[model samples]
Target: MIKRAIALAAVLAALLTAFAVPAQAASGRYFYGVHAGLAGVRDYHGYVPSTYRPGTPMPLLVALHGCTENSFGFDLLTGFSALAEERGFIVVFPDQSTLANPAQCWNWPLPTNQHRGLGEPSLIAGITQKVRSQYTVDSARIYATGISAGAVMSGILGVTYPDVFAAVAMGAGCEYQCDILAQRDPDEQGRAGWREMGSRARSVPVLVFQGSADPVVPPATAGRVIEQWAQTDDLALDGADDGDIDAVAESVVRGSVPGGRTYTHSVYSGPGQGSVLELYMIDGAGHSYPGGCSCSLYGDPSGPDASGITWDFFLAHPRR
Candidate 1:
């Protein structure tokens, strides 16, 4: 009977681990009334570092929540608000609307929603703009990030509105175009469209965390995302992988977590040694943020520290 009870307890724990829940925001306030054109309105919440003062322009991080996730839950998972408080920056989380998607997802896989200045992308950018307008925000240092669906949307924002976002980070996500046909590889025309859009938008730096054995998003998609972002940010319109458009260099480093999984960190550089793309491919990580708060719903503490590493990347690459 003791073994039966223990087995049942283990089963319950496994169920909880699989079904993720969003954490409540720690900065404590959930604000509303901010509206984006056509996309309607959603709740906004965040935390300001203790050192911040009124009228001082602070850097803003606009984080988007994944399906069935809330701003507060997102805050608890990534611990970005806590990091913001500690590092003297600002972090804002925007909730997804059920009207757009029943799951409250960002609608990243839809073809119609993939374009710039339209669909959910516009709404997200509007939230960032609204936050900037209300607060003393540093226009040049704004950034975006998310988990899963939200992460894919972050990639869309980076391509769609590069002028607004200085840098982007995504976990267990795909590129801007994740339609069914684009799953294996994006067609030539679609790839060209992304390249053109990114070029016109003044492409920003991107950081991606992809689980090698991701069950939802095929891990191959992450490599494709890197290829698209690297070529697009570099403005390489050439069709071949080994093309002489400009200079593309990559450096690789390997590391492991103590009593946990090992991972590979790859940084892709463009002209002037600027980091255009960074990829962390964790060997055993699933569909969650690496080194994130395990106590939170959607996190795996066995990988690299995402909040810390991504923030460092954000600081290094401001809008050019």
Candidate 2:
């Protein structure tokens, strides 16, 4: 049994290394480096727009990649860097070490990495702080977005580091402790997230995109995530789960990309805030980044423009 386990470990390590950290082609705006924080060291990449000035504070978006993907390739798949350049914001990509997870996943399922001031959450926050320190980042406009495992990690960050991340965008993923593999009650998972927030709890605007036909993550996962965030936000708003955020009526819109997939968009708003939560359910879409470049394995050219929608939502809702 020991020998078999060792062999399995070896194979997994090899597979992870195969797609680990490829050297990205040179781009003057794009840069890479390593950061060592209290938890550990991690590799990170940053994209600074050409219009950025030294003293000007621009919005910062932290993009986290899913399993089997790396920081260097996420932009290629999602076209986030291009959007950042056009929108005049700084974007950072925090890499996951293969040693941490054999599949290069963010380890969101592990309780050790779910809370504040511990594990992968700390490392990712450290990376975001490092970027803010180096670049002229608007603290109020800092946001996080990711896909799959990275999406789950983004939800965890919203709970554990609410002050650090003003809002979060998750694609093809579930909420914190929702555990797509285990499939628990979203309300319970949401309460757990609220507890994790502790005294730092606040309303963190969320943008979620889910594929209707996603095989790895069920379509119902989107509803689960929405429920979790609504519950968490409800508790955060008044320290009591009184159906505050949930009581607000959600506006739904149906649309489709030309010759692509159709989708349903839902927006949930707070009492004063325009929108605290937005969900996009893409019909017939698979477990891939919708409206992304098809160059990468996880990118799908069909469906709504998720990256664009996420940015618009992030821009609308800052740390207020």
Candidate 3:
């Protein structure tokens, strides 16, 4: 059993190493969509690993872009496609509807937008379903991740569609605050809707990555989200600790979300998840992708390699 476990770990590590880090020469595809008879199309880019086969059920990762960026920007900045090529997974980068928000931001905080039947979350869920129908996807292994506003959307998805996504890696996002805001009586229906959606996220495993120095989303917001998720999962709370830091200088901290049968928390470095929830706190970073690389915008050269870390966390847990 020991030798078998060692071999499994080695295989999983190698798979993650090949697909989690950034690389060059990643391919992209554009998927056209027309929703509810709307005469418009959204662009989604798919990145498949070099070793992908037609019949194999590969995992899928959906990468969402931040405000002011499109699907293409997400592809250029995160370099996840390179990792997809190595890991033998399918990665889909969905473009936000410019018509909905001029800045292309996901309406994560709004209650109506968080629902499943209609709105952006539904659109995304539709996209995922469509992709699965067209490809050999391991439905149980589907995951999501994003930057800034995109991170918030990821949270919404985890909460709204707990069955669709196994885990989520949210970078620089926050919890659903509509309930608190609605206490002021802004919109009673909206508040109720938000709470309803929040209730749906009880089973999803989330790995949150936030930079302490991010100006867009305060680092404290990340902590609050971790706590919120912990409560939602009905897990006993454990204390927090610092995880690993990278050569670029970014650091991570983690706390446990107690499941009745298992204990799960974010780890800076270790084997993948056997527990329920994990949170990754990126220290001294900004609202950008990490690693020792340079880019035009939103790429921190002095931070830890986040792409690799995000993938590691995603691989550790499947949807439960």
Best by TM-score: 2
Q: Look at candidate 1 and tell me the lDDT of residue 302.
A: 82
TM-scores for candidates 1 onward, in order: 0.83, 0.89, 0.72
Ranking of candidates on lDDT, top first: 2, 1, 3
lDDT of 2 by residue, 31-119 (tens): 67798877788998777877889889999999999999887678778777777777788888998988888889988878888889899
- Lowest summed lDDT across 10 adjacent residues in model 3 is found at 240-249
Quote the positional error of residue 37 for candidate 1 in Å: 2.5
Error of 1 at 204 (Å): 1.6
**Which has the greatest lDDT?**
2
C-alpha root-mean-square deviation, candidate 1 = 7.6
Which digits, one per residue and each the tens of the lDDT, describe model 3 over residues 128-210? 88888888898889998888889878877776787788878887887644333323332233233235455353345677777
Give candidate 2 misplaced runs (Cα > 4 Å).
1-28, 181-183, 247-249
Candidate models: Cα lDDT each: 0.74, 0.85, 0.63
